[model samples]
Target: MFRYLASASAMALMTNGPVFAQEHDHDHEDVTLYRVFVGDHADAKVTAFDLTEPDRRWTFDTTGQSKLYAVDNGSAVVAVQSNDDAVHFFTSGISLHAHGDHADIEVTEPAAIDQSLTGPRPFHVIDHDGKVVINFDRGGYAEIIDGHELSHGELESTQLKQARAHHGYAAPIGDLWVTSVASDAPVEGDAAPSRVGLQAINADGAPAGDVATCTGIHGEAFSGAFLATGCDEGVLTVSDGSDGPIMKMLEYPDDLPTGESTGTLLGSKSMQVFLGNYGAKGLVVIDPVDEPHFRYVELPFRRVDFVLDAANARFGYVLTEDGSLHQLDLLNAEVTKSAKITEPYSMDGDWNDPRPRLAMAGDEIVMSDPNAGLVRRISSESLEEVGTVEVEGQPYNIAVAGGSGVDHGAEADEHEHEAHDHAHSHDHDSKIYQGYFDDAQIAERQLSDWAGDWQSVYPLLQDGVLDPVMEHKAENGDQSAEEYRAYYEIGYKTDIDRITIEGDAVTFYQAGKPLAAQYASDGFEVLTYAKGNRGVRFIFEKTGGDEAAPRFIQFSDHAIAPQDAGHYHLYWGDDRAALLEEVTNWPTYYPSSLDGAQIVKEMIAH
Candidate 1:
């Protein structure tokens, strides 16, 4: 079976399909999985695992203790080993491909890519658009690498330079790079110069616009269309404008006490809001559009770590020194839920000392407990400890990347064919449903609708017994006979040869062994295809099954209602939502009693 890898050539080939313009929201199955990467405080190693299956884990040895960043939308994780002056990339092996209406997901073994970035003190790693910029503090430049190329093991980068080295950051925005400017004065030893302001530079590293004053600018985040950076004066914001790059400062309200300023900012993906650290014991929710933008949330104790809920932007999570995990509501700027999860991790030690770090996995909050030597999972809604994964050393820095998406299985190549504008000709004629599917009378179906013994058609196609069927399709279809045969070779391939449905029980047979399960109707979904055709997936959830039996099974016949199924395509997986996302790898089956010639005749008749 061909596993989908996010390689350069594979990505290039994927772009050839037609973009899904519109999608109808309907009840569909989705498979959601997450991979979390954790950096040890004292060890030069990063551990990773699928949150649900922590027993099966992957580890990568780094040059020094590292800070992890989830980049390329979680397809890869960047390890910024500051003390070692080296940066490394690890493929999370979990990728989600969004197709306007739905997304396709592929999972493989996580491994270290060939590319590595080394310089003097690699500090900040920023991912924007589809590019990742790694800031080398003492090198006076940040290397901007394309996220796609990096996923494919490419090390090429464009350097965004400054006059002198400084503890600063730069982000790639459109055609220009917004970078921090350091003072021109010489520094002692490896110490960096103090930041003076921010400026936009062209691809050639020349100044693009006037430098905007941002004294002591340190932290930055992206909220909607705006990029906000922290400064002593206020929050420096930048956005792409018709004239050029628009840079402005949102000054802090005068009513705030002295020595109170936000240094770290977390932006919401679902809303245009920024959550920044206000002093030691307060969190500020900044609204860019409204006046009196700052909404301060007072905590019971000093903050240990905080993270924004990117999936559900309504809430944020904060861990205080009292070991309490508080859920912050962004809209109201209030602490909604709180629970003590770990032992008190005082804020009295060094900034880089072992402590809890926060990361989001779907709607759940994943926090690292260094003293406990464990990574804990807490429900965002209940604020309760749901699970934990043990680590050997102090789990310091952490990041998570994974989401719900459909797995198209081996039909990865078939999706590339969809990018074109060719009309897909089906063996069955469009007699019942025509034009827009909005008028189609779709409804839920019973297991009895497709009952009885069914045999996979893969062997017939492989043995050239289905050559006449391919020839018949080419005569009435858009593709050639050879092309249709090759496409079917992938689409109809399957290990399970026979499936028997009796009452609520279904049995799948491979070779001679049978795995039976009891199934219940889970509902159905009508999907609009890229070719303007629509099909229905009648879903079933396993009520009781053998250990190896799939948790979910869905059938796609040409029927949309209570008609008996003749031949159908079947999809089964543990993740119901993910199985619905799969648009390819449909293993088709016909009546087991039908001979090769009879099946060919039935195909031509359809």
Candidate 2:
């Protein structure tokens, strides 16, 4: 797919005109500006098209065959040359802003190849949190380049080299670097190494320790703070630890029949899991923390490309060669929906043949059809074709950039109108409270803070008193309250994941379930439950500036009456002195059971 070149006449037809004019209309305010940078293998150029307006934004002329890699959340695209030893960066010229209720995107001039790096066989480029790591497999070295610097024509890089040369990958995690290990010995013929290991390099450019063995490790991905590298045996999991980075190997289940090992690994940002390609007709769902981590799903045909829904944690889209899009539910490990969007592009040619590539542009799934020289857009919500944009030559490698955001111009106008209509003001004095109270008196005050570690501590106030039956049931547990509390705290700290904020929605996947929260007020949000009467209300209040002690409160009718009906205080700190201060100085009540109090005391003592 990377071998096509443009003719002289065809190259002359492509224009460098302004893709988007500086016309800021109210209609453009709420609309998401989508840009698809297509690397035409046959044309040897990158074309930028505004999918929102359905127009060609601009075209970048690459001197040779290239492959495009999206970086900085699609704000930029890097075209790595296939015929030479060089890489180029193209700015999508789209800026996204979030204003809670809506979004605004500004489309500017496309910056083509503003900065580039040259090396021997610069092929693999991976974007990790805005840092682009380009691996020169043939040269046995990799360069980590700052994505922001590259966009501004500034070059900042860290060079990492292995002991021997092989086709491998590398990723930077804080001060440490994880890279694929080279083959121990050179093969006599053309056969490649069957197995390889991984090594960690410290910031000082020295090996941290011995290599971790994994048979035939190829692709790598990151979900939350966890990193997964696909291997023949299973998957090598890497996570940041207090000491450094910890590595573990999660093998496939013995009951599952073995096939070809996964070479491409895709991590879901919303969940602590990894999605991998199993051979040519299957998809593997892997959860590093779960027992029997691997779950395979058979496909109808060979997969063309797939992408996880950034806005919907539970949904993923897979475009097969049969010209159909299948929506996958990661929670159930099954395809819940499917739609045919294009003509069948059989997977019967060379691996490098121009086919289709899938990418998510906000709520839309963009698929590039190289054979048709067109890009198809499908709504992720409906799983139906929305629009299509035609490009010059064969549009092979495609990357999308843009999102919804509120327009500041419209917001300013609305505020101006509101000011003229009514003089709205807030009373800051009434919101602030200052006091000291004993634990008993504090319990009578309204609960304010709720952001902290909380669990169901039994003797769950049945009626207005602790239930003896539930209390005894809790006491029969294998682990003591102190032990369980300690263990829970450790796990909670280690599993520090985050949710994605898009418009009014905050979406994330937790405990194999999709969870979402919608913005309500300044310090309040609404959490929607899959099976519940009304969504729970989450109210956050900043009690003190010292250590920023913010309290989280959950209000729901379904909660246990009286005790949980009001605001429920969530305790997070293990400092006994701090806890005592909160109990004595703060006007709040600890509504936990007697055992809960004991657990808190033990945690504080430890």
Candidate 3:
């Protein structure tokens, strides 16, 4: 009878185990793990840990107080020592790179400081592309160094000086330098400059244009092609133009409460928006690209630390003083999910006290708990607690440095064949031609022949209208039939003076100064010519083909294509005589679908 009962129990258990078995199998699958790096100030050490593993991978002790910055897609980490007045770079040990369909991460021996930089009061460090810019507040100068040069022990550096240096910042973008402009007014009993201006320096170290003025200028952020500087009155927006950097002010809404401007701004990697702290308990989303540009989201408590989810363009993680992690949906501008990961840590203490900090490792969000001596990993997608690693001492500052890598074993044969094929292919050599025009009329005339858009060349005329030809007298007083065309065209002007293409990289120039530009996608490039608390972006795309002169379309912002088309187009080749004939017979040459005449009237009316 006992045997019979046992058989019946086994049968019943098997019938109900399918669901449990499926869940277990799903969780045990080979999931990609990301690595997290933490900087413990009190311990004077930096530690690395794998989120999926329980053991700590490695740790490095520093000379003094340390702040961590992960550069080159987590290939290395730079620790800025506050008291020591030096910065140290170390290999993260976890090497991550793309292969084909997937990514791979290699865990190697922990490396010591590969390079060291010494300066006075080195506070802010910025990584624009591979170049690192460190600002020495007390020293009143900034150092620009190349990351690749660190390994050769021959790093090239450029020193930038401020006007009257009082804890300011400076950055070098391409051939342009944007630095803080100190006020000339005398200090009144410990008060510094009430108003500061942003100054642009050209390649030759001369002023590019007039200083962009802003009162109480502070924090800075970059989105897409533009850089924004915050101020008491408004946000200063800067962009690259054909002539020089253009500065504009986006004033705060009249109905909004006063005394609430951000000094700390976080830029998004996927979207053209900025996340900033508003007041003490609120967060502001600044989207300069669209309508209702500024949106505020109120938090339950003051934010402890927050970071943009670079992998996910739509989400950001915010940790509040309540020890709760909230997922911010950038699209909806709301908190979509929340999870309590740690004990309550009040924000009422001194600013320098050890507090929780946030970092992202792939799809996982890592939060360092200084008081608990722990780092908790949570899944960004599900908002669930996944794992935790015990850390020694107070882990105040934290950064993550690993991503997905392709499996070598899975695609070894496929990659080898592709490599062999690429080795024998002929390479295409592309060159960039930059054109500068002092007058808009001449620029439009030049661009029209290349883009095949006669309407843009002559914005005031109708589709069937022809540019009038005038009879002129030559030097000998002989009558000569010459076409007299109006120079001024009705369109938004560009700040870009020239464009350059070297290999796959494309750069733009303004006032004979080169600005940093990146390929946004196929046939499109976004140029950042302005540098400072505020900067500018010029989006250009290649159109047409060998059948006609290749046309270049320049857009004011990133939004390109029809309905939301570009501001103008620049046509290649200077066939003025051919273009003149084509424009004269507009009905035969111009596209009937394009209502150029109506578009110009609407643009002018607006």
Candidate 4:
């Protein structure tokens, strides 16, 4: 059985027609099954596999040679749209169409036309809540296709267009999409564009007559209560919704000296939002709900583009031109963390160089690493390295399956722990404080002040908490799940470290001794800066719950362990990593002292 790993070769081979068998190493009723539907940068071929299962492989080449990007609308079906003006549907069912049949090749149905749209140059396609929406740039129009199978095999499209042609999008509701249309007159040069706005289009192509226009409106996002619109002057705030879905344009509000911004990102967690840099080197957050002022949040590097953390809901990731995934915090709108992804794709070249694009498949995030030729998985929760898999030539888009078929049993178990514990903590008498801290963070912030990054990134942080000891457990059995280089292990009891065994879990560093116990999984790096020695370590601890006896958390610091090691961590980062592990509902914050003990005890009593 083949498990996806992170590497250059893996990225190169991500899109091809070959089924594979992947192993499952868990004690459960079912097996780990996954099928990744990948589209190439150059080739018109579409790759499919049971990402979780990896037991078989499938491939379907698009009828027309168009660049394809896909979004999973649940089940094993994917909605794919290429540069060409059409949307295709591909399924992973074993039944095969004739080899000569490009349209019939394993297709449950024929290709769906973007009838709602008039002009070509198809832009983007998104499947929100089973509604398939297609965007056309040539003509400022969008079409919607429902995911449900109708009695007839023919596919239908719904039309929704703006008054003028401009570049924009449809709001989340799938009804009213925010878009841009052509200006009234021509510009100084061929560079066209006049005004942009939030146009409410009904299901049948008709503008609601109410348009909240922004001069340079480009990108936007809408929650039920508020809508963030990006433009030149600043974020245009429109809180005056007569009723129904509120619409407002938040002009560029950050204090940057660059040009203008249209790329606006909205977080699902704290209602915070982000705006890409004017020229691409900067980003900012405008929390109109909290701080109405446009705040310029600096970034480590300028981004080619950025993606919202759908699974994580709180944080988002940016793929820089330098080939790195910088972890972003939407609540605060800042670059919180970063990790290298590839050896850097040539930015000096053309716009369509088959560079890696960032996408989330379940909790696993797949980046098309052209130089690395591999797609790696970063723990959405821990934001640490977990595992990776190889793919073919410049994987442009990735559509994952089976994760829906079988929710990450292990990953879900981890989330269940937080959900149940969170409710329990709220009821607990604990003072309700922030959770844990990193080495650099520990110096400036107290352990009890873990909020945004500290809490959501590591569930140990929250609004209110009592005497709380946020501990993580990891274990290693004879058969390890992923194989890679370097790992972390729970080692000996040192003068500063205390190791205790309470049942199956080997609790280490009770009072925060390791400085940063971030890597609580097998074979992690310590990153000893003062000493400047890079090595590796191995550790194994068991889960601390009754539901499953062998549950544990391990740590492998690259500086202290051997290379070629890997493990699955999905509970902490941005919930985009593919390392879906088996999880259980356990306590996230365990009381080890009196401060929050009474609260927890009170919660336990109920």
Note the Cα lDDT for every prediction shown.
Answer: 0.75, 0.56, 0.53, 0.40
> Compared with the true structure, what per-residue lDDT tens digits does model 2 show for residues 107-130?
577787555778777877777744
- Tell me the spans in candidate 2 whose CA falls farther than 4 Å from its real position: 1-31, 97-106, 151-153, 189-195, 409-606
Model 3, C-alpha of 342: deviation from truth (Å): 1.2
Instruction: Name the Cα RMSD for model 1.
Output: 18.1
Full ranking by TM-score: 1, 2, 3, 4
Q: Which model scores highest in lDDT?
A: 1
- Per-model TM values vs. the true structure: 0.66, 0.64, 0.63, 0.53
Each candidate structure's count of clashing pairs: 8, 12, 18, 148
- Which digits, one per residue and each the tens of the lDDT, describe model 1 over residues 217-247? 8899876667888889888889887767889
Best by TM-score: 1
Residue runs of model 3 more than 4 Å from their true location after superposition = 1-33, 54-56, 94-107, 150-155, 187-195, 203-206, 407-415, 418-606
The model with the greater TM-score, 2 or 4, is 2
* Model 2 lDDT, residue 469, Cα: 24
